[model samples]
Target chain A: MKPSDKAPSEKALVPFVSVDHMMQLIHHIGVEEMMSGIAGYIEDDFHRWELFDKTPRVASHSEVGVIELMPTSDGEMYGFKYVNGHPKNTKEGLQTVTAFGLLANVETGYPMLLSEMTMLTALRTAATSAMVAKHLAPKGADTMAMIGNGAQSEFQTLAMKAICGLKSVRLYDIDLAATEKCAANLAAQDIKVVICKTPEEAIEGAQILTTCTADKQNATILSDNMVGSGVHINAIGGDCPGKTELAAGILQRSDIFVEYPPQTRIEGEIQQLPEDYPVTELWQVITGTAAGRTSERQITLFDSVGFAIEDFSALRYVRDQLEATGLYHALDLLADPDDPRDLFGMLQRAAPGNA
Target chain B: MKPSDKAPSEKALVPFVSVDHMMQLIHHIGVEEMMSGIAGYIEDDFHRWELFDKTPRVASHSEVGVIELMPTSDGEMYGFKYVNGHPKNTKEGLQTVTAFGLLANVETGYPMLLSEMTMLTALRTAATSAMVAKHLAPKGADTMAMIGNGAQSEFQTLAMKAICGLKSVRLYDIDLAATEKCAANLAAQDIKVVICKTPEEAIEGAQILTTCTADKQNATILSDNMVGSGVHINAIGGDCPGKTELAAGILQRSDIFVEYPPQTRIEGEIQQLPEDYPVTELWQVITGTAAGRTSERQITLFDSVGFAIEDFSALRYVRDQLEATGLYHALDLLADPDDPRDLFGMLQRAAPGNA
Candidate 1:
């Protein structure tokens, strides 16, 4: 065959892990084990967080929803995730959030991986919470109170189980059907599951409280009275301005740890608190610069606002898995010409058959 | 098949236009005709420029190159382009720039289209220049002096011919091979092609002067003495900061026009000019609020640094063509659970056989 007719070179093909592949990979590694693996990567990245390029995500808000681009680089590698959140989408049988991401080599500015990030985002968010909880969760914490059990509910539960060695989870949601779905999905797992009718009942004897709901408004998923000292709280649902989960009373009572203060203050649970409220950076805790769980009776809240570096870590992990599993498709997403300057020549030579 | 075993739902699949498909689409419509079609879309969008949500692109700069995310939105649809530039990539047999983009519905915040944009960007950049020249070029202008015949050289020439009714092109490049490649690419076209040894030779009797060199520094491709009156200049190569093709003397002599003043002041040829240097916004001219070419002897310059709205227009045009031409593949890039909240249940159902 002539050079013109040859298949595209590897550089022109970005390794794309589709939804199906991501699912298969998760199953291949076991969901809990995969979450543990992802948490490990997040921990590695968080330890070296100073090396990352961080910026507040670029968001475009419309009447019903918001779309955002979260980008970051570590001198050698770069990544970005395109995600959208529309709380009303579920009513139309669509996901409330869907996402995709790209990872590229910073040296050549060429993409190395293109992967579906809806599933991956769910994984990474859960992993980040669990990884943070490892440092802050009370010693031998075995029970978790999972409120607002929606799409993210179960992942958060299993990630806690995998990374923190939790043996039981008590789930609660305002919607009974959502609670039932979470309970049924976990029935096959080794961990014990409890379905609680009220948020108060879910927190009974639980040391870890994970609240993940889907609402665009600031709804009180957990009030101050329900949270107690010596327990760790993972607040992930409050991830945008004007949308928060924990009551201001709970925030006042707890020592909050955050991903990036600039972002968390705007999007996380602390959006309810004063802008100048002091919160410790999670990376500092991981890097041994700040204290984590200094006292058993001290309430600790991981005010989680998903950051770009966690997604970058997830992309890096997925890219490393591609070669071993062969669970990816080579997407012809870039134009490659033999003579890089002659793009027009390449187009001319590849004129359509009908033309 | 079980519901879980069935193919992904429509909402889970995003339409992806690969490079091969883009080339096929371009060939089917003819390059000149395709660019004119794009120019038509651009004109329509430019007429309503005030409605767009615009922001300066977010760029990640490394030692060797830069990657950027350019995003914009109309009230109904939003779009963004991810592009990277690495000038040294040519030595590694890669294009200096490559890109891909997405368009989404503002109402749902779900992506509607994903397309390879290296080819599309080239087309849009050329079409934008020709579209601006059509409004600002001297009336009945026929010959264009094409300096720095690189990747974008052929498209610029043909777009001028197709949109502005140019009859001939005079090509010149510092590198002889580039000029030869451009000349050979145009040999199949109907327009007259002339190869010149130097920038001065290329401008002989040409009414339009187009400069598009790929360099990261300020270089005087066109001196003040080389440019005469009654001519239009399309200065596109001077895009990033510290990159300029025309000397300040030439800019001072011409009536500079730009896409967006805020960005153009930083990235366009006008970057060399004072911060408050007066320049006409090109969209205003299209909107009839600002004057374009009025006097024959008046020197006109289009300091073209690409804007996000142009990429949005290109994405819209490509998306509109997808249905009619059936030129895209539906990529399973989103996870859609039967119950939106049952993502974990979906994962359980799709557990790997090896497990």
Candidate 2:
């Protein structure tokens, strides 16, 4: 290939960060510090939330699962993520969720970054929960109850410790092997890891309760009586229709806060409540327009269905890291002809012996 | 990176076709033959159009341009194209359009193929035009008048020759250099090329007419009086909201056929007509449910705004070609952990020394 405009040069190469590079970048920055940095970006974006073009994700549903496209543009840049959720995938030795994302420049509509977002999504989801809890959780809240010790449990536990000063996490799962796996994964962390036998015991004396079960159905991981006042509940697994983790009784007692009420109403824990139920937007709380944890007895619940802006924030954070760490390879994704109208000439020239 | 299930393995790597590889593949398969093959696939898909899940594209419009995601599924396979259009990019030595696409399995929600679609889009669009012309053009239409000699002109000319037995092409463009470039690119082909100085001379004695100008505004390259009866008009440039190439009178006088009614109504030549204006879906014509060209004196117009199914067909065809050609490499796109529940464990094991 020539160094002309038709070639895959700097103008045509899109920087791609693979799973290996993503893991190395995570280890380089340290998982906790990266999550904390992503939390900062999310908070900054939240303060300017009105400037973003917000829409509910475009979803394609099938009998087995759903594929979704989450897109947002902040006037200057555009970002989108492609993710799928097939609960039965875990049974097939596959991840229940796998994703990748792209970020593009608004002015030229040229992609700037393409990244494997499955790991990045996990980091962003946990960072978001912890970031919201930092605003809504009670003062000096240092202990979190992490129920549903699956893929997301360790990240959630660590984010709480890194972002919200969570000191200890009590883990519980119906599958004891999953709990054992999570406990083993977290054995080297600084925080205390407590293995609980039941969901009630997992929430005992913890000011923050995080539920991340992976069942694709409405299963009550937390009952109304198990949650105490002044506790912040970070619900993570109730991300799609017919899959909820908390009972309606628990939702009724907690003062709910959500990211994008329209989406959370359909896919978040708030889906169980009435359509017009009053819920404070977490952006408003972050922007100081709405109150967060007004008193010790105030029960604040961050119903996290995860939003496009949070993914956008995480993508933005990773893109910023690429230049410094050089953990990326360029993919020749775009066809760039020297003369814009001479694309056929370029193709003809590329023939064997023609060039 | 371990192969014990949480690393980039055969399950995680999506086959990628870069621009360089795409050019090599095109040369390997020959452009005209590839277009003819894609045409066959398009016809096959059109015959079963009712089985597809079709929707209008999701477009994010900016001041300078627009980026769109076009997705479709056939219950077995899912496909989507990411394309951007920036008309001003040409002046800055950039492509007006660039695209990439992906094909995924609907059952497992894992990507199977990731391809650079800028060149593929060109092939598919031309194939769709020529395939429709085969069904709608007047009998013995061996000559075509190609107006607006931009990036798509040469492909249209070649496709007509390859698919419809077109023997001659009369080319006219606002920029004379674009026409010269197209003619030079087609010199090796077994067809007669005639360069016309004006649109009137270009359409003289031509039975098929194709308009593919790239202006973003509504400028009529072909007026009503210039187009005579008994000719098929392939309109390709009127694909976005404010972009059109034909006069309203020309649309009124011809029997219009479109890919999808809802999308064509907003983005095709039919946008000039009344909201209740009657038009036929081209799939119906392809499947023998509707008439194409009933009489030699009747004028037919294929209002091809391009559809997702045509791209799906192209992607499917490419995926089928990959195994035999081996013109592809894998991108470590998906995060596949051996134990689906231990994503954190996968990450922890990916550290430099830990692995």
Candidate 3:
């Protein structure tokens, strides 16, 4: 049957989530709550990882940075993220990374949501890190050393507080002002915050260590000696070719876990290692197919380069919340003609002659 | 530098062209004029095709349909289209293909334009076909046949009339109401329209023939006997594996042209031909690197499965027009924190105590 046979009101137009609306939702729901909610979704999706059709993100690299499209589907829903990375963008008064994404119905291939994912990415990335930490970090982990404090630092602190029960954060950045800002932001919450002069100082005695520096090269933010036994290392900054945060010895010493092995092999810190080096996929641990942190003294490393599945979970979570709160503004993103075949007729009717 | 370092008003947000606004623009400009303008942009871009970084679209296929992302860039600008094809969507009262795209600056990796391309795709596909016809069709060609009169039929007719000097069209479709509706929509224009009972009757004596049927399987809409010498065929509907329009015999007899040979070889009619079947890239002919129609009696076929460059050109054209007319709404698609490094602070400031 054609669209003409359907009722006028039955025509489908996809709902969109804009950046302003996302901010409103974050404000209304509280960022801490949003991060926790997304963490739940990430955990739920990760448990069913075998249901998804996953692939490495497609990237177009240039001298300045890289632009990527990360797409995934789980038979019922489809999602993708359009993201860019330009470390130099900060110098030009732009964010180092920006992103937007879409969620669509797998059955009909119609987009259900269009959302600004720059903020969502920060939330989701932190949530994913925390989710992994919950599985791999030692029990009663109370302190996290947040190295390379920047735009993402606060979200890391919030997600850790919500998901991993982190109560205190030690912050350090090459730029002291960034660390100061991170410490001040965390102080606004109920959590305890500390400012450290160096990475070694920040990581000392911390149960969890997160390196999220924004540099575009292979800069070692953490050495093997700085990390302690049983510490869960959430490596978030080393996401592109030639950009890594950990020393090779640290990776060799830890039980490394990754999102997708093929992608992480190319983009994660493992890019520095030989192809045959062993690593466990996080989903295996989440699904109880593999072990996570076999011993309290075992150093666990989550070499995350930010996978597409996290974005999928984040988009779906945000979309559901927006629908529940009725906080999203609908965009005329798809033409809803009275007769779908009469799209041209609608244009004609709206023309000057008809008007 | 922080955003506050510059005047607050000087920070510009990216303008968004919604599908509703794009439809309104088409109405204001007249569908005929809009098609002509987009055709001009496609032609201009095709002439400089070598300047573009082109790649075959990346597709994720499911049991029901396929979702795709097509990306291309010049050194200055980059663009990509997120589109899906599910012929079964129409049965569920949804469009078979829905798309949206982004245009970004290569220098800073900043997204400059994000617009809905569901309606825009019909416009660009028609424009691209007309552009190829302008360079490849015989001189003084006017009458044309459009098989498979669906949502795309009227746009193709308008583009042909405005770009290729077609004054009359013969429409044919498996669904009779589709042809009638298409003919009625074109009644206001100067072109004469006829509803033909069969594809053979539609193509008889026509200088140009366009087949745009939407079938997910290999179904021949045009036979070798129906095609005449000197006729320029715009075959658009057969764009994926297991989907085609012209019969293999007809393809063997015509001089075929494609957008990008590497891509079309797999997705276009050439999928039926030998590995080394002779075919010309439309850009070659547009740039005078190859000859188009050698004589009035030569049968030329443009296997036009819409390319990323055409969308890129149409996106830039629409963006410029939207800016000139001030018809687009600005979307805060990207977060603009006071300091780029203080994205988390934006949330902190929005907290209850701060607010």
Candidate 4:
């Protein structure tokens, strides 16, 4: 065959992991193993967080929801995720969150991987929570009180079990159907599950509490009186301005740990508190620059607003694993001319069959 | 088939236009006709520019080049282009710029169209230049001196011919092979083509002068003595910082027009000019809020660094044409579960083949 009829040149193709491939990849490594692996990558990035470019995510807010582009680079590789959060979408049979990401070579400015990140985002968020829990959760913490059991419930449970050796989870949500779905999905896993009706009953004996709800308003999912001392709280639902979950009293009681102070101050649970509220950076704890969980009586809360570096690390991990698993399709995404300056000639040659 | 084994739901798919399909679509519509059509869309957008969400492109600069995300919305639809610029890439047989864009439903936050935009960017950039020229060029202008016969040279010439009724083009480049390739590509066009060795010889007797060199430095392709009165100059090559084509004397004498002043001040040819340098917004001219080409002896320079709104307009045009042409493939880019909050269940069901 002539060169024109041959498959696209290597430089013209970007490796794309579709939703199917992403699912296949998750299963290939096993869900628990994948969660553990992703946590390891997040930990490595956290140790070297100072090397990354850290800017607040660029967001465009609409009346109903918000769309954002989170970008970060490590000097060698660049990555970005295009994501949206519309909490009302689930009522219309659409996801409240959807995402896709790209990883490019910084030297050449050419994309190396493009992947469906809806599923990956769930996995990475869970991994990050579990990794942070490992560093801050109370000693011998095995049972997690997973309030607001929605799409992220099972993944969070599995990641906690895989990374922090959690043995059981108590789930509660305003909608019992969501809790039922979470329970049914985790039936085959190696952890015990408890379905509870009230938020107070869910955290009865658990030492770790993870709250991730889908409400766009500032309704209190966790009340101040419900949270006790010596338990680590992983708060993931309060991720945008004017959409927080924990009560202001709870934030005042707990020693908060955040990804980035600037972002957390605006979008995390601390948005309700003063702008200059003191919070410790998670990377500082990981890198041994700050103390973490100094005593069993101390109340520690990880205000988990996702960051760009976490996405960058997730993309980096996927890029490293893509070639080994072969669970990707090469997309003809770039236009490459024989002579880099002859794009017009390339179009001229493609004119024959079009007529 | 069982419901679990069925194909993905329609909401899970995004229409993707690959490089080959983009080429076919361009050929299906004649090149000049497509250029004119894009110019029409751009003109329409320029007239309604106040309705757009305008923001400076978010760029991550590396030592070698830069990667940028340009995003905009018209309240109903949102679009963004992922583009990279590495001038040193040409030596390695890669195009200096490669781009891809997605048009999304603003209400749903779901992508409706994903398209390869390397070729589309070329077409849109040329169409923008021509559209600007139609508003600012000398009356009855028929000839254009096309400096730097790179990937963008022929497209610019043809766009000028298609949109402004140009009759001929004079092409010159530091590399003769680029000029030869551009000349050969435009051989079948309706416009007269002239090849020249020197920039001075090429601009002779031309009413419109276009300069789009590829160097990263401020090398003056047109000296002070070269540019004359009443000629419309389309300056595109000097897009990034520290890159310029015309001498400062040329910019000092011309009535400069720019897409967005905030961006043009940092990345366009005006980067060399003072921070408070006066330049007209092109949209203002189109909207008749500002005057364009007031005097016959006045030299008008279009400082074209490109803008996110132009890409938004281009994506809107492609989205409008997508269904009619039927040249796109549906990509499984998003995860859509029957129950929006049952993502864990979806992963558990895809486990059969992974083992």
Candidate 5:
């Protein structure tokens, strides 16, 4: 339908999905199921990677943090996310990160969906981690160590359990309360939860080591000495410059895979390494163009600093789900005038005195 | 407060405002009055120009059109506008341009307001034109020749009358129906509407000449022969590369003014001039740091391409007005959690069988 086709009495509006609605969707579908669906979407898009128009996020940095806009499109649909990173936010009783996004139809250049992405980001990030683990982790992997239990920990644990089939999780965090809270929250789940005293203790005998520390520094949570053979590392934190989880020696010994090499080279754990260092984009593995987990004895690392395209996939998935469920609220985000040229007339029609 | 504190309960919530709400606000407050108020805000911000952190807009250009993000801040408040330009859109019954924006408190980096700017853009553009005319146009300029009557023409004409005190308007458009529609809309108002056959006839004896045509190419709407001494030219349509209104000869003869010279040099009529061509920024004129209309007989030109700060001002004004009148509905745009670390719990709370 054209923008000008609407009669004065007809109102064609955009739809908005609130955070509450998104949470309801997740709860109803189950986080595990949601992550699996999102993972499938990401994998489907990754296989057709060349169709996208990609760019490094545009960032505005300040002393305490950075705010950025990440936009990507595939000719027909355009999506963008507004996100901020402020590591000190936790100390101030705020989140270190929060985000929202919009998905628009490129044909009309009109916003079709506006969504709360903060929760979705957590879900997508965990789902992405599991997608990497599926390809990079050794077969029949069961035990996993989660270093740095924070707000994102439970989601990661559940996604791994649901998507990667992990059965046991050992948790460690510098903040004991955070780890305790995480353990308490997951107590009823089928999987085992171990509150380890130290990072070494947490990693011992684990087939997968996931590092998601919130420290805004190059703290080596996983030393080279602690990692064993045939381990898969899902490195989620150390996503900004000067923040890293693994020691340089660990990277040297592992097969490092990344999401969007250009961005990961600047923001991921590999930021500590030289630009020419070897790395592989995960899409290659998903598309079967490159080998993943070459041998059971090899260490595989997925250094993921979130990318825009994944958000695009998540937006599309959420929009589709919301439409199918008929749970979203409609919003007048774009103007749909009776006569497209007479936008001012909308004001006149809505005028209290005139009506 | 903290993003973490707000993360869990409202992890994926974003508030939205529809075009209806925007029109509601405009109708509640008379359009003439809103234009006057916006012009005041634009003038106030322009006077304190140095306080703003300004940058040239970031744009992604495709063969069909261009999409751009314009961001600016004044240490305390930050704002950005997402806009697109596709001259061919009207033929497909879509707006030539559409926009939306957000205003955030810089100290907290929390978005305070989100708005649909398609309608607001037309209002702000008109307010900006009138703001420039207030400083550069000759005193008591009653008649304005508005070339290219389209979606933007009505707002421009109304704002000129309300903010710049123009009593009569002469309308001309390539599509006679568009000009006829614009004249018909203004017939109820106090101002006299004159429909002219040609640009020359429209420009005859008019004190201010406004060129707001929708063409995306370099089409000269005004030539040196049509413009006489002392007449003020509000060049509005020629805002992108290869699009211009005044002939190079006209620009050479007039005392030109612009908004952000670096951007105007690329998008404004001055794009045709040399890199070293002398021009005064409108902010300088607003602040009284530069001369405007040096003599009643000296021609002055306000080469308006529209700018981000004006939108910032307009957003702040609309938000404040909405809040004061209780006309704005609260949006759950940001996620607010009871316990920030319990983001995963939110999903469990929303689980299938849970209330």
Candidate 6:
């Protein structure tokens, strides 16, 4: 028998969104609008959280970082993300985090969407943060203090503007160049961008404080003295075990809300506290089952550890918009033989020179 | 900001082998040779199984099927397979199992290979069976009794012929058409094929009995009365809970061998036995740390549920062969930026009209 390369069947082609295509889709919809769009999907899924298969993300941790598989289903559709986080990668001219995701049919288990999620993850993470802020921030909040301006700083600031109607963003990072890069990126956007020299100065007079430093340590990007009452804090940096950005004193003082308590307990700011530390589920707040910001003097904290359902929602949103935007390629990713049982026959018929 | 779909950088492209390409590659090497090749890799990895990170596959079970993520790493490289098993799918003109896999560098956590594993999985499963049979089968075993002639029947037989020097095969299935299909696929091969009407007839003079029926429930494909002494049983179909092939009495008499005892106990034929049932790990036997077939009357049953390390070995083999074959597409699956920290800049630079 000879060998031949055969073309994939129609059923084998999965709609794939590359990073460039994702950027095009985002720009076509506008980054801020896309962020708001993803937030809407997140909010919708959170409203019906009981229907989802809410298993924890499966992880493979090594000495340097962790690679995780986040999967979820809503009876009809299923989705999973393959994401890796290696903080040391940035020093080696690689992104600290890179991701790709897939959406499939629960009934058939055939993949419908294959997407590059490195950019989309940044988008969804920011969108989730701002969406939580909209629920927990004080009324008439307009300013946000963004500490540790990095890859996510600009997107987080824009998402807050788009979803929570934030007017001004103050950026602060120990690396001055990172702050400058973020400020330059947002210079042409609608909101005000202020490059602050210190985290203390960045939080002054701000109604919302977002901490997004990228270190795998327990460094305090925002200390107890830096936070004030009547403010919503979005902590996006401390997402893995042994990694936290805010001081422990601040957690003790604030009302903490988290996405899926089981995961957040292991990989969020609350990991510093006792296992039984009281925290509110953000889904309950979205569904009005739990209280949000109640008093002007109280500080509310959204411990934003990423979740599988959020990736599921993001994949769902991509699949829904892909056809309309025409921003994806058909990926030959699965096998579909005419006679499924005769898989061997299909291979034999694909012999070289037969075609 | 404008949007443009930029071509992925060389670093960002992952080599993708579709099912069609997988078949072509297999044909290029010859199916029997490919089977033996995969078996060799599986055997090598089995010998050093202690170096691998062994964990139970993460599964999401639906009413009709399951979607699973099987991940394993050898400190240097990481691999995982996304596979689904739906027993009723063949009735709907879909394969009962479909899969795709990814291999990545552990140092950088970046994907290096993305291949369609639907056909590769079939090849690897068969190779694994043959490799285990080489260690546990009766002395001078030349014939195999295959009870389920489904998609895996021909592959299994060919693999046995290539690796274990099998000279003849006896095939039996509840569906006559499946048996005919298996027989027809092996008609031109080097081995003699016999289509049997019943399980008892199939195992008449065979020294190895392999049961691979596709039933979801524990319907005994092989009972204690039919089995003879000194024969090895390769049980492949009983891969999930509530799914078993051999009778509990057969399990009681045979010396069970398994890949990853914790996983096999939950998803293999041993699920019918007590949790503390004595079983030897196949790796220990391959490494000469444990005993194999001891006497002419001893029955060795390999309870293979398939492990991540096997898939890892398969992925590694494909990656090594990819460059020589040129049987892959460069999938733009990862986002690579000129400045890793400036992912936003990459997206912004991709704005169509701006460029």
Runs with alpha carbons beyond 4 Å of true place in candidate 2: A1-7, B1-7
lDDT (Cα, 0-100) at A322 in candidate 3: 66
Instruction: Provide the lDDT at A223 for model 2.
Output: 86
Per-residue CA lDDT of model 4 for A127-211, tens digit only, reads 9999999999999999999998888999999999999999999999999999999999998897899999999999999999999
TM-score of chain A of each: 0.98, 0.98, 0.95, 0.97, 0.95, 0.97
Query: What root-mean-square deviation over C-alphas does model 2 reach?
Result: 1.4
In angstroms, give how far residue B238 of model 6 lies from its true place: 0.5
Off by over 4 Å in 4: A353-355, B1-6, B353-355
lDDT agreement of model 3 with the native: 0.86
lDDT of 5 by residue, A64-88 (tens): 7777788888888888888877778
TM-score-superior candidate, 5 or 6: 6
- State the lDDT at B253 in candidate 6: 92
Query: Can you tell me the CAPRI class of model 4?
Result: high
The DockQ figures for the candidates are 0.87, 0.84, 0.60, 0.85, 0.49, 0.76
Better of 1 and 6 by DockQ: 1
lDDT of 1 at B215: 88
> Each model's interface RMSD (Å)?
0.8, 0.8, 2.0, 0.7, 2.2, 1.0
Going through the candidates in order, what fraction of the true interface contacts does each contain? 0.88, 0.80, 0.61, 0.78, 0.42, 0.66
Q: How many Å off is the CA of B350 in candidate 5? A: 2.8
User: How close is every model to the real structure, measured as TM-score?
Assistant: 0.98, 0.98, 0.96, 0.98, 0.93, 0.98
Report the interface RMSD that candidate 4 achieves against the true structure, in angstroms.
Answer: 0.7
Candidate 6: where is the Cα deviation over 4 Å? A1-7, B1-5
DockQ of 4: 0.85
Give Cα-based local distance difference scores for all models: 0.91, 0.91, 0.86, 0.91, 0.83, 0.90
Q: Give the clashing pairs for model 4.
A: none
Q: Tens digit of lDDT per residue, candidate 1, span A161-230?
A: 8899989999999899998888887887888999998999999999999988889999999988988889
